[model samples]
Each structure stands twice: as structure tokens, then as C-alpha cells.
Target: MQKYWILSLALCSAPLVSAQSLMVTSFDSIAYVNSHNGIQASAHISVKNTSASVKDYRLLRSRIGTTGLVDSNYFCWDLCYPIWVNQSQGTVTIAPGATANDFSGYAYVRDTSANGQDSIWYTFVNTSDANDSLQVMVVYAFNRYVSNSESSLPLLSVYPQPALAGQRIYGIPTDALKLEWMDLAGRVHQVITQNDGSITAPSAQGIWILRAYFQNGIRTTRVLLR
Candidate 1:
């Protein structure tokens, strides 16, 4: 289907040319990250040439299906490439029995307001072989993201895409059950069980999902604040 095709393309943009002639020493599968720090997370994965001959290896990044949870991530072989660049433009030739510690994988949390885990894979491929390669799974365990139910709720009318200063409410009935302001991960930032059609926006300055509890269900919409 169209959905799967898009995911397949997002996995790895480079053509397949890899083998297991190289030995990749794996690191901790999980990388813990704090979204509140607003810092980039990185993992060090070392590779060694296991074959008798000098092995040339290329590093590739693969973000497939629901595996990508971070805003952006990439790998570093000889150099670091942008997230858009799936494969390294250069390859490193490792002498037999020699290990290369120059490989490192990185990920970022652009949305500090929301907290959730993300995963990305780094693969070291032998440029000359067809069945030789090694992969590292870096699961960024974020202590911070969006709820499926809240995202699927009916859209409510909230003014200002990038809401300037303070908090304002509009189109919401004062008699509603209650109003709740939350982030994409369903973390409640502010809540008002009673108010005069007004809600407070968190100072985090990003897209936030706002909702109101109704008798039957709930209505939700996203707001951006300065």
C-alpha cells in the first residue's frame, strides 16, 4: 500500500551493497535521554575488520516503519551527515585485526515540551560483500510525546497559531465540564475545572494539544505559543 511504500523509502535511501566481512562490536542497545535538557544524544559503536584482507566499510542509517521516534537522527562514519543523508559519502578501510572507533550515532529531541522514546539503527556494511553487515539498535529512552486518542479528537477553535504571551480562550463554552491543556504525549500542563472561557499556555513554546472534557466525549486542538 501507499503507507508501507512511504515507510520503506524512509528506511534507507541508499542501494544495498553490504556484507559481514567486518566485525562490529555492539554497544548498549538503549540510550537514555532527557528531553528537558534540549541536548543531542549519541552512541559509540566500534567496528573492526574480521577478514584477512583490509575491509572497506560504509555506514548507513535506517529509520523504518514505527522505529523512528526522534525528531531527527543520523550516523557518523568518517564524518557526520545530515539527517536527510542516509548513507555516508565516504568509506573507511580498516586493516585486518584492527578496530575502528570512529563510528558514532546521534539523535535529537527538537520538541522539548513532549517526552517519549525514539529508536534508530546504524549499520556498517562491507562494500565488497553481499551478505556481510552489522547493525546497532539505539533506543533513545525519553522520559518525555502524543496520545492517539487525544490526536483523533474533534478539533476545537483556538486562536493564534503561535499564540503571543499569556493565555486566551475562545469558542469554548464556559459551562463545559472542564478544560485541560496538554502536550502531544498527553502530559497535562494545566487544567481548569472552572473558568471564564480562558486557558493558560505552557511557556515551553511549541505545538501543544488542548482539549475540553464534555459529557459525551472530548474536543481537542493544537496551539503554538511564543
Candidate 2:
């Protein structure tokens, strides 16, 4: 039998305005665990005010969920907690054309089974205007293997350590379905399909993360771009 668990966050109030001008600069969509002890999943999210004026916003509310376990009460003993911001009350101001310093949320889950699932969500609203807001959510799948011998996924490798601007390739499983290249800022620079099979480094020289999606699971690795 397989077990499932969930952790989530929600907004306490709805935005007053019908239109939102805030944009999420970057986000992470997947997390994983390989043991019964569980793991913490987090993402640094950045927001920008495209509007001409400054905007005031705050993290309104949050929630966490866990399910399909023998002891639900065990999660409360420090394994789970709510998302938070650096500000006093999760409030901040963003100037036009400027990006807010990274804000992040994290969740921890422990699974006794080989397979488990969880999720996290965050809601931000414009306190001054009500119309400008952003919601960030990430889903996590936990995999617990008895031993390294039980794993069958092929190793994923990226070549040209410190790849040049125009030369890069990911040595992935033949069954790979999609590839995503993301920069440090969390912006997705490119998406490649199996038909294309092209791996191009970002224009800027720095560190980048590559995500490979296969029929069985997903793999993420970092590479340096020269």
C-alpha cells in the first residue's frame, strides 16, 4: 500500500482590485525526499512592480496540510511550520522597475513509505491597492528506496563544465521528455523538447540549474556557464 501527505498555504483575504500588476520573477515547482526523515523544500521568489508607482503588499495568510499517515500528530513536533517573510509582519514595498529582495517559504515532511506527496503555497496581496497580488505554489513528491541498489534511473550528466556561451548538452536518459534551463534569479531561460534536444547555455556567464524531466521522474543539476 502507498501513503500520501500534503502541506499547503492559503490567503486569508481576497484582493479588492480586479487586475493585478505584480509579476513573479522566479519560482521552483518540485521537491523530493529519499528517506523516512523527510526533507525541506524551498524557493526564493522575487516580485516586481510594473506599474508606474510604488506598491504596498503583505503576506496575508498561510495553511499546511498532511494526510495518509499513521500518526497525524507526529507532524506537529517540529516537522512542519508556516511560510514567513523577513519583514516584521510580512509587509514590504516595491518601487516601480525595481525587484524585491528574495522572499521564501519552506515546508518539511516525513514519509514512512517509499512514495509520498506534499505541497506548499504562499499568497501575497497589495495592501494599498488590493489589485496587485501574487500566489506561489510548489508540489513535492517523496521517494523512499530501501537501498541504492533498488534505484533504476540513469545518471544525468551535463558536459562542458563551465560551458561556453554557444556549446552545451545534457547527457540524460533517452526517455527524457523536457528540459528547462533556469538562471540564479529563477527565470526560465529556455525550454527544450525531446524533438529539439538542444542544450544552450544562458547568455550571461554564471551558475545555472538544469531540470530534466523523464518518464519516471525529474532530475536537477547545476552547471557553470563561461
Best by TM-score: 1
Candidate 2 per-residue C-alpha lDDT over 106-211 given as tens digits, one digit per residue, 9 for 90 to 100: 3333355646554444456777865556665544455665232223544556676768866756555566788767654334567788534447677777887675
Q: Local distance difference test, per candidate?
A: 0.58, 0.51
Lowest lDDT 10-residue stretch of candidate 2: 70-79
What TM-score would you give candidate 1 relative to the actual structure?
0.52
TM-scores, all candidates, are: 0.52, 0.44
| Model 1 lDDT per residue over 1-226, tens place | 0000000111223232354566555444333555554344556666677778888878777653264456566555776576678887888989988988767555555665645565666778777873678766556655432211123333456665568646664656565687866555434567788757666677677777565666544455567777
Worst 10 contiguous positions by lDDT, candidate 1: 1-10
Question: Evaluated with lDDT, which candidate comes out highest?
Answer: 1
How much is the lDDT of residue 64 in candidate 2?
Answer: 36
